[model samples]
Target: MSAPRFGRIGEGPAAPPGGEAFSELLAGGGARVVRIASRGHADAEGAWYDQAEDEFVLLLAGAARLEFAEGTARALAPGDWAVIPARCRHRVAWTDPGRETLWLAVHLPPH
Candidate 1:
């Protein structure tokens, strides 16, 4: 048998200029785990993500804010987590400019 995989959740490549860095950590059984590193990145005005898969996001470092289509926003700090249903319209409203923000996102296949 092969050894179990090992990795750190808080470590990742640097974020790209004016963009976030994404890394796929694991995938199996129609599920994907991604690590996103962001610094001062936000969605363009009126742009939103309408994903077909359900996403569960966990804030691992720094801070951020998520805005939904319903005209509400939720702020996230380290250790905060949220489950976004599939087809939910949402966008990254803000991210910490002075520090790197790390997010662990799990995407589940559509029903």
Candidate 2:
């Protein structure tokens, strides 16, 4: 089969807080690759992601903080990588509006 494709990053749509902007790079069977960008605000609310999927996030730019419902928090900087387990209640606590936070998100089933 042919490989999947993706558009240029600058050509992608703008993402808003509490939401995300992404461009699919690959997809097949039960796995997908996407480039995402988020500019979460200080008051951004947390959301419950699907409990059956694991997500790998790479920070490409800017800075932010991630907090989990279990009371764990971490500061994320450029080039930082985080693997959020399935069913984790997490949210962005702070973000630098002066800089855009670019992320590469890989979503896959639990290994």
Candidate 3:
């Protein structure tokens, strides 16, 4: 099998059940890059992600809404980008179901 291409990977819902699709594109030096695909996916009510790594996410296709623990929510469309600090809780609020929402996320290990 050949290595995966960022723009060529299959997108949409997870093949199994109860999850979005996540593919790790790169990992090294305590940093990781990932691709996430959401097809009408959202975080469970009151669920938040508190991570030790800082994340910078770019919306590559479709649209989404992200809510943060700081009581802020932002709509993201194609070409939109967001920088989330380490341990800053956040959650996926919504995504378009008609099409896949693709995201390129870079996770930098906390210092």
Q: TM-scores across all candidates?
A: 0.94, 0.76, 0.84
RMSD after CA superposition, every candidate = 1.1, 2.8, 3.5
Worst 10 residues of 2 by lDDT: 42-51
- Model 1 ranges off by over 4 Å: none
How accurate locally is residue 102 in candidate 1, as Cα lDDT from 0 to 100?
94
The reply for model 3, stretches above 4 Å from the true place, is 1-19
What lDDT does model 2 reach? Answer: 0.73
lDDT of 3 by residue, 34-66 (tens): 888888888997999999989999999888999
Off by over 4 Å in 2: 1-11, 16-19, 40-43
lDDT of 2 by residue, 1-96 (tens): 867654665456666864567778777677778786766555446563444678888888778788887788899998899988877878777776
Model 2, position 37: C-alpha lDDT score: 70
Alpha carbon lDDT at 17, candidate 1? 48
User: For residues 23-82, what per-residue lDDT tens digits would candidate 1 score against the true structure?
Assistant: 999898999999999999999979999999999999999899999999999999999999
Task: Tell me the lDDT of candidate 1.
Answer: 0.93
